[model samples]
Every structure is written in C-alpha cells, then in structure tokens.
Target: MMRSPANKIPADGEPELPGVPHVHVASVVSALATLDAEKAGLDALAQAMAGPLGAAFDVAVATIHNSHGRVIVTGMGKSGHVARKIAATLASTGTPAHYVHPAEASHGDLGMITSDDVIVALSWSGETVELRDIVEYSRRFDVPLIAFTSNPESALASSASVVLNLPVAQEACPLGLAPTTSTVMQLALGDALAVALLQSRGFTALDFRQLHPGGKLGASLKFVRDVMRKGDAVPVVASGTNMGGALVEMSAKGLGCVGVVDGAGALVGIVTDGDLRRHMAHDLTTRTVDDIMTPAPRTVRPDQLASEALNILNSRKITALLVVDGTVPVGALHIHDLLLTGLA
Candidate 1:
C-alpha cells in the first residue's frame, strides 16, 4: 500500500536520515497520476450531470436555501472527513451546517437532528452500514436528504429527496484500497454546491467579511470609513487661510497635510509638507494657502475600500488621502492607517 509523505514513517528496522530527506520519485509520479485521474473524474462528472441532473442541482440549492434550519452533514470513514470540511465551507459561506458522525448518531446524537434540518449524506457506494440510523431518522422525521454517492440504486439513494450520483471512477490506490479520486470528487462537488448556494443567495463580499473578520481577507474588505480619521481630527484650513495658519493646522492635526476648503466648505486644495518645502523661501506669513496648495488633489470616497485606498496611495506615491463626499472633505486617511490595519 502506498502512503503519502504525511503518513510515511520509518519501518521497524529502517535507518532514519540525518538531514535533508530525499523524496521518492516513483511515489511522487504515482501521486501525480492520482491527481490526473481525479481531474478527469471531475470533468466526466460535470459533463454527465449537466445533461441529466442539472435541474436537480438547482432544486437542491433552492431546498437548502429555503430551509429554516441548518444542514446536517453525515458520513463514515474518509467520507466523514470530507463531510466535516463540506460543513465548514457551507457554514463559512452563509449556509449553516454541522457534521454529525453517523455512528455517534446511532448511539444518541440523533437527538440533534431536527425536522427543520436538511441532511447531506456522503457514501461512495451508498451502503455504509454506520449511516443507517441517521438515514432512518431523517426518513422518519421528514427531513430532506441529499445523497452524494456513486450508486443510484443503493438504499441511501432510494431514500434521498435529492441524489447527486457521482460518476463511477477508479480509486487512485493501485490496490483500490484507499479513497483518493472518489474523495476528491466528493470535496469538489461539496464546494460547487456551496458556491452555487452563495451566488443564489446574493452573498456579497461585505457579508463574507462579516463572517470571516480575522484574516487578511477581512482587512481587504474593510471600507475606507472604517479606518479613516474623520470630523475634527481631519486637518482643514479655509481657502484664504495663510500658509502660517495652514502649517499650524497641519501640525496640530498631525496628518502632515491640511485640506483647504472654500466658503461652501468644499475642498478646494491640499497643502502637504512638499508644498510647504516648495514655498518655505517665500514670505510664509504673507503667502495665502491658495498660492502654494495643490488644487484638486487625489482623493478617495468614504465608502471606498481600504485596499483601493492603499492602491491609490501606492500608485500616486502619496502618504495620505482625503476622504470626501463629492467636493466636501469628510475624513483623512494616512498610509499609517492602512499599515495599522495590516492593509498596507
């Protein structure tokens, strides 16, 4: 039997390597062949289902979407691992899901199943003995059962409300003892189902950010409003304010720049440290901000994404951006803000 690198260990009498372990080329080739077979299997399954069960796939999505309760995923052995992953993907993508070991269900966990829940059962042959109790319970309680298997005529398939009969394919294992291609197909199908449901439900990136708020993805989806310095914290000076006053505002606000607003409170220009450097030789107390400020400086909207703001800051080689509502400046965003949020 072939073992993956993760499961491989030294035999009883085999000597351990000192350093820089060598990979087995033949094992790698075998693993590549298994990956190729699974790719083919997925293509074949997609083509087969497109012709016959396309409408059924839509029905399954609708059923899962309309259900008031969570999706209960169940399976045994390797299929159980795939089931757990499928449940996690579904939960993270807006569909509520949980994994229940069928063996545990037969003992007492069957009580967790509710009539409002939908059942997604995984079995390659559709005849795993441990899954019998959960299937029976789902049947008796009138919960919708979605079966993922290779046999259409199997008992599990016969009892299901919707059956996703995966294309028959060989196991990648040379001895046909381990599940490789079959489990890949199951995982791919689970991902497809979750994505279809996500699109059907009109799930937005904002909604996804709310669900996953701990990672780089969360930072990427954060809005400009979430991090920008707003209101009185923003450096501002009237369009007619002297360079002396603008400099004082820039120093007081500590944004390294000051926004110049017109009589209507519309941003007319921005005076950065660069502007101060260029005009320092001039009579600073006599020079008006309009004489040295950059007119129509690059700006971002309060509703824009921080990532986009980062892009602007990068492409323009600027250190800060004024967040505006039309011509009205509402906030200020320094590169430090994005850096603080891990978005830079």
Candidate 2:
C-alpha cells in the first residue's frame, strides 16, 4: 500500500514542525487525508460490487420502498454511529428508516422486526458479537438481511440476504486501530443509497420539507405565500392616481414599489425605485401612474416557490415582484422576504 506524507514541516534550524496536532489546521489536514483514502476505498468498493452488489443493493432499495416496508439499520461501536446517521438521512429523504441497537434488537426490540422490514447490519469487521442474535433472528424468520462489511467471508456476510462489501483502503489513524476511512466510506455509501433511491422514487424538495421542518432547510422550502404582504398591507394605487399618490403609497409601505390597479381593482402596472430614477426627468405632479409605471411588470403567483421567485428577481435584476392572481392583485413578495427566509 502506498503512503502519503505523515506531516508537513518547514526546513528550519531544528525542524519547522508540522501544524500543531489536534489543532484546527491539523484537524483539517487529518480530515482531508482521510478523505483521500476514503475516495480510493470507495473506488475499490465500486469495482468489487460492480457485479455482486449492484443487484443486491437494488434488492435492498426495492425491499424498503416498493414493499411498504421500513429499513431497520443496526450496528455496534463506530459502525453503529454511522448507521444512526445513515438512518437519519434515509428517513429525512424519501426512505422510511430507523436505527436499532444490535443489543436492543436481541431483546424485546426483536419484535419490532417484521417480514415487511429489511434489516441492514453494519460492521466493518462483520464479526460483532452483539449482532449475532439479530442476525440469527433475521435468518430464522427469513427477513431480508443486508450487510455492509469489509470482510465478505465473515459470519455477517455469510448469513445476510444481501451483502455490500465496504472495502476501505486504510484508516487515517497512525496506529491503524481506529475506524476512520472505513466509517467515512460507509457513511458516504449510505448517502449514495439514499440519493439514488430518492431519484428512483421521484422525491421532491417538498418531500424533504416534510422531514425537515426546522432550521434553514424548512426556510428554503417556504413558499412566497408564507411571507408575502397580503390584503391592504400591499401597496397599491389606481391607474388614475398621480405619481405623487403612488409615491406616497410606496413610501408608506416602505417597499420602494407600488402596484397600479385599474378602476376594476385589477393590476394594471407597477412602479419601482428604478422607475422613480428614470422618470425623475418628468414632473411627478401631473404624470399619471401609466406615464412612468412599467406596465405588466413581472408578476408572480402568491403560491410560487420562494426559491423560484428569488431566481426570477435575481435574473431580472429587480428587487420586488407583484403577486397577482390573473389580473387581480393578491399580494407582494420582495427580495427582502427571501433574504429574511435565507433563500436570497
């Protein structure tokens, strides 16, 4: 096996030492070093699974989604932590997943396992004693057992209905005793599985929104309707109104824009800060809304995606969009709203 530099140092009187270990810089270097090994390990795993695991992974995916069954992921030690994250990602995506500790599964938790559920076991060595009981139970009941392990010849692989061999190149640990590259590759592969299955099932951002209801993700999927100014809060003026009246409405609303409605109360045009600048040459006292307002300016549906609306605003070089239902004005959504929601 080839090895890379253990540490980088500058030539000095004694020896310019490497970035201090366990510090921020060293931590980054260690993470990158392990990432390089993980990439190589994944490449090898891809080659090994080209024929053997391609179909097996498909079966595991199909078992969970196509059959109205859940994927029960389990592991011990470091593998268990990775399994928990994998389960969390899978559940947040389109796949229904949950993690079960191997020891717990052997107890009354075994009842949680059903023929409809697929049991996925993760053990780099594939010989965790805590996994024995659940593996036996899965086999006896004929429940699908999908195993991820570096050792295909181990007991875990032998008993699994489908085995995905995770062949890590090497650990990043200098002692080579800690699980480093192995767990990273396993976790990344788990992500790959979730993304692939998500594509297969046509999962959308809306589906993701369902799972992530907190934080920035929830904010990303928020619609324009969620934060738009509605009812009289929307700044508007009649087409017969002078630019001074329109400016008053726009100034009071503090949006730097106003929607001009016709006598029928339908949106006719819009005026913006840009219009104010371009039409400053004209007298505002006598000019009607039409003389300066941009007619039928880009209007968005109140129900449009905030991300999509942000794109439109950015692409058009505009700061605000009129929310109109057909010809009737409903509300106004602005770039600032998207900024407030973190989508801008």
lDDT of 2: 0.83
* Model 1 vs. true fold: TM: 0.87
**Backbone clashes (count) for model 2:** 0
Model 2 residue 111 lDDT? 87
User: CA lDDT of each candidate?
Assistant: 0.90, 0.83
TM-score of each: 0.87, 0.86
User: Alpha-carbon error at 266 in model 2, in Å?
Assistant: 4.4
User: What is the per-residue lDDT of model 2 for residues 1-344, given as tens digits with 9 covering 90 to 100?
Assistant: 55445644423443222655522454566667777877777787677668676777777777666656788999999999999999998888888889999999877899888888888899999999999999999988888898998898999999998788776578877678888878888887798788888988999988787877667778778778887889878999988898888888998988889999888988988999998888886477578888999887888887777777888888998888888888888999878888887766
- Which tens-of-lDDT digit does each residue in 239-326 have in candidate 1? 8888888888899999899999999999999999888887787488689999999999999998898999999999988899999999
Model 1: CA > 4 A from native: 1-28, 277-285
* Residue 250 local lDDT, model 1: 90
